[model samples]
Target: MTNVTPRSDIVLDVQDAVKHYALRRRGLRAPRRSVHAVDGVSIRLHSGQTLGIVGESGCGKSTFGRLITGLETPTSGTIRVGAHGVPIAAAHGTGTVQAVFQDPASALDPRMTVRESIAEALGKVAGRERERRVDEALAAVGLTPEFGVRYPHELSGGQQQRVCIARAIVDRPDLILLDEAVSSLDASLQAQILHLLERLQQDTGTAYVFISHDLRAVRQVSHSVAVMYLGQVVEQAPAEAFDRGLLHPYAVALRSTEPRILDEGTEHVERIVLTGEPPSAVSPPAGCRFAPRCPIAEDHCRSVAPDLVEATSGHLVRCHKPGELTLSGVARADAEV
Candidate 1:
């Protein structure tokens, strides 16, 4: 049985989470298969910290976000919220989970005013107090009360996202799933939203699962970063791992693409570039899912899978030859995390 013991500071705990969606049979005799959206993924997030999940499109990062938010149930494994490790039934509940999705235009209701939208998220608050809380949330997101009377169409893109943020925080949830929350906004607006998220975290101590394809944005907000590929984590480490060093080849290639990670006017000594897109999740190849695209792939990597092994303190990588590459990191491990 899973431990599920209570941990005071742990805000969210996930163990071997697997979410698969079965596909319809092509014919009566066709073998059944499922899309392996999120396979054997596990991570822990503490209060007031952000875990940034970065990966290319169709890599299942969004699906993982859905699992954490309870929007979709995992096909297997456990997701326990609140005081970490506490069994869901035997635990005290402070595990309010909320989500701020990518597009604010479609996310907000066309009919409801800003205050009304925020008040709805407050659930059962009285009229007067709901109004107060709504106003407060607006203020927290740097909006004025005058905007509250306006409809979704009346607000600009940035303002609409601010309303979305207000809705997520109006009830003061313990965990917020920010799934590409700022991706739709322009660079200036994205900076504003990112800063706003940080300020709100300081004020409310809300833990965040910030899922994005934008590695640059992820680095700005994450305490730790996890890179996913074809429904599995290729590497997990502290955000400093970007500069301090990354182990997995996939992670290295992803990092090299980010110009900001390199110093201004200085060429990176170990820039890795990989070709081709990720294979389909429905029928990913055997062994490491990243092996086909990995520049350092060997016969062993193609035929045999590698476990996510701990390399340094709190840094885990899934690769057959994690240490042999020019990626820049020492890799030695005896056990899995």
Candidate 2:
């Protein structure tokens, strides 16, 4: 299937997918509650595109990544990768799509050398060809061929993560899911890895679904961005839109709180910190999940859930009142002066 061509358009498509796990309280008579990890999310990744998913922890970002990459089966809904039409569940271990997991060190085999680890994905190729491919993959990620002989334990955290990346890209799969791939790296190293990934996509034409909590990183590397809140996607838009505006309150709050350098000087951003912890997944609030914390919430927002709708060109938002800006109240009052 390596030489087989894929359709030149959409590379990955996920329909309204839902994944829930049962959480039982320690009571003989108490009823079990379900934790809705990923609740009805739909997304599309076009050929050679990078779609970044950003959210607070427990917002189901990683779970959604796992679902799209076929690491776990969804409780309900479908994921289709490439033009092969393979069921996402059936695609795991077969390498139709691959994942570079969060914990880079843990994801690699401590006992196996990097060469062997990458080769494991190739079924059973000749030793020479396998070695060559391993070298090529390592080089593609800025690692030399000699590094392939070293075990995961011998490599630094960044090197180890590159090994994981090499393994994922070695087979030239149609798509890759990067789940917090650079979260553990230092700032400089993270930028290097992100640049390498961008180059890899350009060189190989591989589609990427980048899952990260770093809004700045998402802005730097992604073509499009999707914001998830409490197991649902509250907004999705082109990367540029993140700077202009975000319709969902959760997305707006996240963007406001993200850290950034002030015009490349030493001065760093002072963030707009959000109050309170995220609500429990077992029982997300009725109506808008963010209603409890939303500054502009009205009775209608508290009484009914909002569906994701197109708010602008290529921008999708889930909000009862899309044009109502919470801070605009202050801006309007100031404007009258």
lDDT of 1 by residue, 203-295 (tens): 999999999999999999999999999899989999876556677888878876665545675564556778888899999889889989988
- Which residues of candidate 1, in runs, are more than 4 Å off? 1-7, 84-95, 259-264, 267-270, 327-337
Off by over 4 Å in 2: 1-8, 25-29, 262-271, 326-337
lDDT of 2 by residue, 1-337 (tens): 4456665578788999999998877698888889999999999888789999999899999999888877788999998887676678767777779889878889998999998888887766677888788889989999988887899989999999999999999988889999999999999999999999999999998999999999888889999999999999999999876666667777777876666556754354434467788899999989999888887889999889999999889999999987465345333434565
Candidate 2 achieves a global lDDT of 0.85
Candidate 1 lDDT trough over 10 residues, lowest sum: 328-337
Candidate 2 TM-score, C-alpha based: 0.91
**How many clashes show up per model?**
0, 0
Q: Any idea what lDDT model 1 has? A: 0.85
CA error at residue 65 for candidate 1, angstroms: 0.7
